[model samples]
Target chain A: MEKTLTLPSHITTEKLKDLYKQMWLIRYFDEKVDQFFAKGMIHGTTHLCVGQEASAAGAIAALQDKDKITSTHRGHGHCIAKGAETDRMMAELFGRETGYCKGKGGSMHIADLEKGNLGANGIVGGGIPLAVGAALTSKMKKEGYVVLCFFGDGASNEGSFHESLNLASVWDLPVVFVCENNQYGMSGPVKEMVNIENIAERAGSYGIPGKAVDGNDMVEIINTVYDAVENARSGNGPSLIEMKTYRWKGHSKSDAKKYRTREEEKEWREKDPIQRFKEVLIEEDILTEEQAKNLQEEAKQEIDDAVKFAENSPEPSTDTLLEDVYA
Target chain B: MREITYLEAVREAMSQEMRKNDDVFILGEDIGVYGGAFGVTRGMIEEFGPERIRNTPISEAAIAGGAVGAALTGMRPILELQFSDFITIAMDQIVNQAAKLRYMYGGKGSVPMVLRTPAGSGTGAAAQHSQSLEAWVAHIPGLKVVQPSTAYDAKGLLKAAIDDENPVIFYEHKLLYKTKGDVPEEQYSIPIGKADIKREGKDVTVVATSIMVHKALEAAEELEKEGIDVEVIDPRTLVPLDEETIVNSVKKTGRLIVVHEAVKRGGFGGEIASVIAESEAFDYLDSPIKRLGGLPIPIPYNPNLEKAAVPQVPDIIDAVKETVRFK
Candidate 1:
């Protein structure tokens, strides 16, 4: 934890506390989902972003409520950070009618448009261009809002990423491309996936500002994203911010993660974003140790209440399955 | 009523929509000052300016995905791909994002975007650029697919597509761009999923799409001289297909022929054939159903080969003759 860190002018102590709680909520929600999957209460596959919570929480905390975001498959953190209710998200994972997508979309497709989330995409690098489009709307309609596009290091190699960045730059669209470089894409390490030291270096190809940050540091993540978002809001065009982080879990429920060593996992766990943020909050006198513990318990209670709501939620009716296909 | 080229009709529709609605705008490669590859968006930039008529880099994925994002955030985006075949480069965005956003988001948000592309095999663009891939999008449940054969249908249907709440894949035939037909000057919209009975007769029903509609009508004229009356039906829209009109026409004619510019194998013709086969019209059929589409092989660059690739007017004539003479 950085003790001498200065918060952004717009970010209040209350907001920081809220962000810390959001990070915990994301952690507890995914951990419970992991338990549900292991117990066979949830079906299909889900990608968890346990150790990468700071990347989502910090970046989203920098955005306004009107600022939209396009998320990726491992998106629970992004959804929660964007102010989506855990009960609806949990019901969605449980395939209930009360879910975000009314049980239609599972873990990989939670969306809260009223909060400006454009939904989590199932395909790799799928949401990149969408962010550019949203920014185009902002510029064209004079909406004064920016779009924060999130993807992984693996997505940097996707043609969509290159194309979207080029489009956003050439058009000077109001968007910030946030690459959550979580070390590995599936089982392949970022080094093996691309021949680059930093994914942000590719932003130069599109003639845009690109920077890399310590993703585990919440203060750094928020500051970097806030700068990028302001640049876009002032009509300077898009910027690429690469947040170097790590996913504590496997790519999906079925991944054994044989590609990495136990030592590597232990190393990242030691740099836990939540614990680091909590320590920073306490050191800053924003909260006492007891208050920090209470926040963690509150997050656990929220997740437990979400699970109960999801369990009691009704299964989606077959009659309504055909609904919402159009319009 | 005024006679206009199909290309002009398309531009007129977009121009009218943009003029009436501030939220409506267009984006594509070479669409700003260059006025698009086919001049479909020519003069639009002058009226709407570069802010509204955006010229994007040659990035199909971003073009389509941007439209999805813009549409999701309360802007109506009319995205133009240089050629419909380039849609393959953007398939993931169109298929995964634009098509599924509304349904996957529990109908809380919608992608009111229209993806307009020039399709067909007449041009010397070869395999990469000359393809009628309407069936590819029509197969998706969350998308609305439309192919307009005449200037009237082109203008009206495009207006409807622009106003649509879901993603609409609007396929404009390359060969039909220069074709002239009567179009009303006032704003009008043709409802999607409604079949147009271009020509009425009692002998056989010719169900055609896009340029095939004109070929079917031409075939009907030739068949009329032979006393074999033909009913030409243009299914302007494919996904929310107007089964009632086709089924009723088949019942009256007792024969059916499905034609399209796409390949016969797994084409939308199969879907139309199934619709007729599963309906009460199957019992009234006096003969077996016939289907005519493009060759299985990729379209070639040579003019002769390109002409030979898809169903021409003569092909439709022969098919209608064969279908009428059946039994």
Candidate 2:
């Protein structure tokens, strides 16, 4: 086991506590999604980021209020980390009329414009170009806001990822390309699909700085992203940061987990980001057992209320179905 | 009013918009120093500087998706694809992201972006570079498709597309760049969905788009000497088709001939024909509706074959005669 690490000087106990709460909220929310799927409550399928909590919570903390993000299909954690209301998100997942997209878009298309979340894309590497465009806007308008684009390790193989990074580098756009290398894309293993060991190594092709980080290490991710965001804001250029993480759940509802063995899952499970951070907090005396338990209870209660709210919401009307197709 | 080439008109539209609003910027390959593939953006880099008149790498997906992201983040970005056929490389970003983001977000935000591409085959650029792909984008519900035939319409409609809240795909004809028309120097915008009656006659209504509009007009002139009166109508914008103007013209003329440069199968002409068939205009039609478009094949590299692939002025004349002759 790794020894307990001290928090960075810039990080306060209050911020870590908030980050802990957000991670718990994401964990509970994904657990509820699994439960809802088993009971056939959610209409369409969903991609869960259960074990990839620290990546979202830590990276988002480095961004400013005006900074924008483009999320992936498995993006509830990202949305929640960027400040989306869980009730609205739950309602959207339930296909209710009050949902983010009025039930038009399921979990894959949730968005929060006021919070600077562009939207989660259903296609792999779909949001990378959009993140670059947002960065272009910030640069042309002198908005002084950076853009954080999130994708999976599998998406790094997409032409969009390469093209977007190249454009961002050439134009010196204010963007951070964050690849959550969860070791798999659906059932395909990254080792087999890609020739390179580190996805970040490909960033050299675009003449941009690239680094691989321990996604489970909350403090390290925050510090790395914080510096990257600062560099982008100052018009330095874009950076590719590959965060090594894992997803405990199957790819989707239909996934049977036939690819990998339980040994591998167990090994990654022992490194659960939320649990690791919690252990650090306890070891450093930042949180007592009662305080940590109360945080878990608080997250569970919030998710419970969200589920009830979604269940109570009405379905969208047929007439309004065509309303939002155009401006 | 002063006469200017269609290329100049497009440049003026972007320049005027960029001057008036700092949020408006132009980006694409060779758009800055190289002045674009056709020199449409010549001298723009000098006026607006590299930041506003951005020259991106040869990455179509990034150009499109980046524009969408910029639009979402409060900047109005005008992205140019070097050629219309090249848009195939960026279908996911343009079709899946830019077109659906607003609708998928439940209309919470709009993508105020314009994608400008030179369409149609005249320079013998071959299969990969010469194409009229506007019909593919027009099929998307959330996108607004515009094809400006004249210099005046080019400037005015471009201004309108920029002001529009939805994503707009602006198709300029490569052959029409040198074609001159009177354009007003002051700022103005044409309503997006309105159709323009280019020429008025009693016998037949020839609805055309892009380069085909000029062909239809030339056909009308040729038929005039033979006492065969022909009316010409340019729908201008396809997605928000000016069904009323088209339907009314067909009602008065008793015949309809839709012409375009795209392949006949599943082209926008079919959409126009279907609109009339589904509307009250079907009852007033004295003759069968006709559609004249390119053959269902890729544009060839040879000048003769390319000319033979799509409609010429003579084809429009023959199509109009056949429509009027039909019982």
Q: Could you tell me the lDDT of residue A50 within candidate 1?
A: 95
lDDT (Cα, 0-100) at A203 in candidate 2:
89
> Against the true two-chain complex, what DockQ does each candidate achieve?
0.84, 0.85
Model 1: CA > 4 A from native:
A1-3
Give me the TM-scores for chain A across all models, comma-separated: 0.98, 0.97
Q: Which ten contiguous residues of candidate 2 chain A have the minimum total lDDT? A: A1-10
**Error in Å for residue B192 of model 1:** 1.3
Residue A103 CA displacement from its true place in model 2, Å: 1.8
lDDT of 1 by residue, A1-327 (tens): 556868678789888888888899999999999988988989998999999999999999899889999999999999999999999999999999999999999999999988899889999999998888888778877899999999999999999999999988988989999999999999999989999899999999999999999999999999999989998899899999999999999999988889999999999999999999988888988988898888888999999999999999999999887788888
TM-score of chain B of 1: 0.98
**Which candidate number has the best DockQ?**
2
Which pairs of residues collide in model 1? none
lDDT digits (tens) for residues B56-79 of candidate 1: 878888888888888888899888
Model 2 CAPRI quality = high
Residue-by-residue lDDT tens digits, candidate 2, B95-139: 998888878888888888899999889898898888898889998
Q: Please list all clashing residue pairs in model 2, or write none if there are none.
A: A133-B66, A133-B70
